[model samples]
Target: MTVEVLRYSAFPEDGAGGNPAGVVLGAASLSEPQMRAIAEAIGYSETAFLSPTSESDPARLRVRYFSPRAEVDFCGHATVASAVAIAERYGAGVLTLETNVGLVPVSTRHDGVELTATLTSPATWTRPAGDSAGEALDALRLAASDLDPAYPVHVAFAGNKHLVVGVRDRWTLDALDYDYGALERLMGREGWTTVHVFWAEDRHRFHARNAFPPGGVREDPATGAAAAAFGGYLRQLELVDVPSRIVVLQGRQMGAPSRLVVDLRPGSDTVEVTGTARRLTLTPYDDVDLP
Candidate 1:
């Protein structure tokens, strides 16, 4: 059997910028190796494979995420892309996804012009980076003085673990040159998915860049998972007031400017990440035969 793959750019800025993700709507028959091969062929940071939970319920799905290198527990951009793709085909509604981490609820809406998806993450938590902070800095070739005093380095999690590093200025965030081998090794040892380096422009606006070595990507243009983790970091540190809306601008330095909106509500442990996804033209390997 041949599986159909769809491409979509999630968290785009005016439908032009965002991270591209591959979506496989019917993947119940595909094996793990086939999924990995398709993801590698697509060459995106991540691809989402979704299978229905039951015959009657199309909205409840068992979703799996895979990067070019390996399978991941959860992926936000791909989730958003998959939600939009499903919404376009079946009309906008809510979806329940059973991921490797836990249950994630995603909702899709059509605002007349475009379709957008919002995913409520699993329970979030944070912990101090401890000795690993220095190792991360060394790998990034950054000094302690470059870090923002207000936001300390910590490992934050929404769906997957991310090291949240706050830099003092935008220039430092823009000029990110790191030792890939060292950072990859550190992340692998630490079990971190991405290094979320960000600069806070204000209480409501921020800029970010994510280094995803494990995913075999040097940098991600727009990372929704990291965005969700950063929101949890702010809440954990008591940096933001409840019921706050934050706009994270990313991918500008990479030439693909993207935007992600994070919402933190009162008394809610799960963070809500909202973004728009646009379908892309079919790629060469849109249809691939099972091995």
Candidate 2:
């Protein structure tokens, strides 16, 4: 089975910006194990596997996401990367993706070096968890004063659940060192996918980081799914009114800087996450075992 793999930097139009993802055009012949191995071999946060489905269904793609450690229900940056990659070669329009979560519609448009994608998440919303901010602070080894009083700690869900903790300043965000193994255990016991650590800069801007030890990645440079869910949380808590959007800056300290945009609509929970893509140097190899 041969699949054409393209590497893309999602959430940023620049070639060096955003998160890197493996975009597979056709993986119908690849097994789940093979897909997982390929994703691991690529060593990105997540790799996207796409197979032909049905055009009549309006969802012409069957998509699966895989991290190095396991398969995931959904991945936002990979979706954005795949959309931009497909649009660059196949032309722009609304593309349907059948993910583990549900059907997702992605629309793309390109102008010069600027490529944009709007991904409709899987009917996202927020829910208050059983534990309060106190427990979250304990797990993160942070004080209540470190958190942004405006944006409280809450669990948000788009395709998966994430603990959203907004900090007060960049100094707090830059000094990020958490118990990785402990966090994995806590997230596993709590059924949380990631711990979204963010710092709000202004009304519509945020400096963000995500701890995803559960998925075997210390952090993701630009997490599209978590960004979407964070937008939902902001709306649910009245932190920000609807019909607005947020620009998230992340990964600078890690050196693979990325930008993610989260769009919100009033009276609705689901938010649109948009970004561009640029091809990277990674390739998909068959008959290779991944470490």
Candidate 3:
């Protein structure tokens, strides 16, 4: 039988921008290898596969994320894309996803022809960059001079582990270059999902880029997970006051510019990342071979 796959661009102002993600709403029958094959075939940064936990509980979904190389614990942009896809069919509302890390709750709001989805990330925390910092910088071919003196490097976790580095200016951020194999090896050893490199335009606005070598991607046009984790980093270190909202401008250097809005609530460990997603197309399994 043919499986169904839907494509959507998340965190974009329109369909032309944002990170493209594949949403597989009917994924109950697919095996692990099959899902991986599908994701590889789709060739998106990440793909979200949904399987209803029970027919009686439509609100509960078992979701899995896969990159071209391997399975990921969670993917925020794909989750946003999947939520918007669900809203298109069932109308905008709330949905709970069972991920590898934990339960994730997503809410959707419709504004005319567009849909915006907000995901409340899991409890977040930060740790010192430690010995990994030197190796990470080496992998990226960056020196200490390029780093932002205001914010130190940190290993942050919202749903997955990420190495967050703050650059001094947009010039450094815009000229991102790295050895893919070296970064992949370093990330694999460190168990990191991505190296989130950012430059603060202001306290509340930032320019960002993510090197996701572990996911078999050179760069992520927009990364909601990293944005959420960065919000945690800001709040944990008291860099930003609580009850703050930050905007992340990403993918500009890559020409596929995208926007992400992150909300940090006082006394709440979970941050919210909100963005708009648009459906691109739908494909049938018959178009490709299954693993």
Most accurate candidate by TM-score: 1
Candidate 2 local lDDT, residue 253: 72
lDDT: the better of candidates 1 and 3:
1
Cα RMSD to the true fold for all candidates: 1.3, 2.4, 1.5
TM-score of each: 0.98, 0.92, 0.96
lDDT of 3 by residue, 1-291 (tens): 466788888998555689999898878999998999989999999999998997898989999999999999989999999999899889999999999989999999987768899999988999989998998899898999999999999999999999999999888988889889999998999899998999999999999999999888999999999999999999999999889999998998888899999999998999999999877765322344674
Candidate models: Cα lDDT each: 0.93, 0.83, 0.91
Worst 10 residues of 3 by lDDT: 282-291
lDDT of 1 by residue, 1-291 (tens): 688999999999987989999999888888899999999988899999999988898789999999999999999999999999999889999999999999999999999999999999988999999999999999999999999999999999988999999999999998989999999999999999999999999988999999999999999999998899889889878999988999999999998899999999999888999999988884523776666
User: What order do candidates take by lDDT, descending?
Assistant: 1, 3, 2
Which residue runs does candidate 3 get wrong by more than 4 Å? 282-287
Task: Using TM-score as the measure, name the better of candidate 2 and candidate 3.
Answer: 3
